[model samples]
Target: MKNTIYVLLLAFLTIPNLTAQDFSDIDKSPMDVTIIRNQNHSPMARVIYSRPSKNDRDIFGNLVPYGKVWRTGANEATEITIYNDMSISGQKIPAGTYSLYTIPNKTEWTIILNKNINIWGTASNYDSEKDLIRIKAPARTAAATIEDFSMAFQPIDNGANLLMGWDDTYVEIPFKNAE
Candidate 1:
């Protein structure tokens, strides 16, 4: 009877430790944040966010619609906080964290940088006049479907090309940052 009790106790004690051991490697995983500066010739800037394309049925059309405020990407709004005032489409945007949104259309997409940042995706709190900058860019059909929505800033001669893509469509917005 004592031997059986001892074995049972040993099994119970070892199980928890083994489970912990399995997750011990998780702490060693690489962190997902990368801070880049002076990138693509734009000074005084930072990009704190990016997200993958959502494959759900309600993503492009049901979730994000035509001539509506989209949270830019999945999850939280694809936020970009700049440390200094910047120029977007010849409009001045002060340094701060702004909620990025878009109104997608067939021929052109309007990118809106709203002053509100803590709200949910496409919340009604968005004000049109409060927008710091509004830029229009043409959209093109892609040969493939982008399973995940993605955004990247590519450096050009005097400015950065903000690229957004998903589900066989891509758009680019160019802005020259103030020096």
Candidate 2:
């Protein structure tokens, strides 16, 4: 009997079981995608981000403090995937994936493209030197308040403009196809 108990305990400990738990009642942010396509109808660049709703909270000064590095979105460090080599804001960025960071201010926002892509938020492990490029984007006031954080790519001459908006604030990042 003792041997049977030991065997059963061992089997129970070694066996792997996964149980699904319902989390539908929890409030969660939804994932969003921003894609910049070429005239040929192919995606040249893309960003995978999480959209955090405002819910009447102050986004700029209170939620996201100025003079700090932000993830540019809600979660996962805001990944940027470049399908082709391009010149972004006078900087040559190679074809690869990168994490986008930004330092927001009243007048302008400094955009930082970093080599590190796997992260949670902000530049918590942010290394200034690891940044591939830094560019200044003028801050502008939107026509109306944007309840959800948003990112989109607007068409340009050869590439697209990366637009980010939240609350009543907005910024743009321009690029040109290098190929």
Candidate 3:
């Protein structure tokens, strides 16, 4: 009985050290991201985003390939909000929150704006008819891999560019601010 107790205690003490070693090699890690729109302005929109780290892998043509549908982020589909009626990629969209998706190819990426806001990682629950807008954007390659996924809005003259990227893949969608 004493021997068994000693063995158990030894095992417990060693397990955590082993686990620490497993993660010690990683210098950086991924974290859930919070993105806010018009943070300094009134009536802003907020979104939460996250994705796995690059982990030294090539993102384009590897982790995420051409001619595939991506959830737009990690766990849940990337989300967005329109505080008021806005024009996206030349199409007008109403004010509300929506889930975003993308169909990627070599030349372009088709952005999908779905009405469903609450979902988990695509969830296989997408309804085609609920989609509010679809737009095409040119795909671009980055010189370096983005260790973690990122989404941000860059204010343009009359609109904003919704930028999404992880690793070497990136796509931008232009949306006009409500008038």
Candidate 4:
């Protein structure tokens, strides 16, 4: 009986795996810095985040579910740096680096700029007490699909329009330059 058990164990150990895992070659999301500059070509505000492709998947409500805190992008948590104090939505925010997070909904989205920085992924450890400001922004449906997640600055009179979009949906957070 002992010889039979040993023979069975030996046979099990001899089985081979048909596939190999190569972690080094796996593709990674690209890091991007989306910025807005003044007429002088100097950066006024910027967003540093990772860009994740849609890959033919639905983004809103499916990939990124509604009514939850999202990292605002892929990979590392999205970060925003302001060179000058600005008034966002209706809150006055000082010029500093902050962590950007969002809660998406069908009609509107809540945008948050927290004092927390250098963290990875969502508001897993989010402390609302550290939030500098939180405001609700209207959500819009894009006429065309955005294949990749993006944050852009559209220059206006005193400031630039902050735009976040993925798939066929988007939202805007307007900021007025404190100057």
Which of 1 and 2 is the better model by lDDT? Answer: 2
Candidate 2's displacement at residue 78, Å, is 0.3
lDDT, residue 49, candidate 2:
87
- Measured on C-alpha atoms, candidate 2 has an lDDT of 0.88
What lDDT score belongs to each candidate, Candidate 1 first? 0.68, 0.88, 0.73, 0.88
Across 10-97, the per-residue lDDT of candidate 3 in tens digits comes to 9998776654446565534333544435545654444566667777886666777666767776777777767767787678888889
lDDT at position 28, candidate 4: 62
Candidate 4, residue 148: how far the Cα is off, in Å: 0.7
Q: Candidate 1, residues 5-58: lDDT per residue as tens digits?
A: 999999998776654445565422121222234654445555444455455554
The TM-score measured for candidate 2 stands at: 0.83
Candidate 1, residue 109: the lDDT equals 87
Q: What TM-score does model 3 achieve against the real structure?
A: 0.74
Backbone clashes counted, model 1: 4
Off by over 4 Å in 1: 1-7, 10-36, 39-44, 49-52, 56-59
Best by TM-score: 2
Output candidate 2 Cα RMSD: 5.8
Return the lDDT, model 2, position 111.
Answer: 94
